[model samples]
Target: MFEQAEAIAREMKISRSAVVAIALEEFIRRRIGIVPLGEKSNGKIVVASTDN
Candidate 1:
């Protein structure tokens, strides 16, 4: 996950923290059944639920 985020930060020309922040916010929105309002980037990211 760190590698993926680092790659995104590099590609988007944003700080790692900024990338992580956006990702977290989008995740929270999705968890609550809200359509995330984040900028729609190219390419798809798939996240799945799992029991810890």
Candidate 2:
């Protein structure tokens, strides 16, 4: 798994640690149902349901 991650990091032109950090952050955020800010907008404040 580490070797594969290294390959991915090289291909993405980023450090392995950076790749791992991003992956871990994304995993934790997904597990906790966190949404990225500004992911959805129409130039207005709107209440949107994320339960898809």
Candidate 3:
């Protein structure tokens, strides 16, 4: 998923680590019943709420 991740990171001019961190956070947020906002793929952004 590095290729996909790098693509997004490069396109957004953000570090790959930052991108991954965002993804993980989104996943956790979703697990906690949060609705994130963004596209999700092998290495994409996901939408999950942030209401606890």
Best by lDDT: 3
TM-score for candidate 1, residues paired by index: 0.64
Q: Write the per-residue lDDT of candidate 2 for residues 1-52, one digit (tens) a residue.
A: 9999999999999999998987886587668876533344456543454543
Q: Clashing residue pairs in candidate 3, if any?
A: 34-48, 34-49, 35-48, 35-49, 36-47, 36-48, 36-49, 37-47
In the range 1-52, model 1's lDDT, one tens digit per residue, is: 9999999999999999999898887798789765555334354343533422
Q: What is the lDDT of residue 14 in candidate 3?
A: 99
- The lDDT values for all models are 0.74, 0.73, 0.80
Residue-wise C-alpha lDDT for candidate 3, range 1-52, written one tens digit per residue? 9999999999999999999998997799679765567756457676454544
Worst 10 residues of 3 by lDDT: 43-52
Q: Put the candidates in lDDT order, highest first.
A: 3, 1, 2
- For all predicted structures, in order, the TM-scores are 0.64, 0.61, 0.67
lDDT for 38 in candidate 2 is 38
lDDT of 2: 0.73
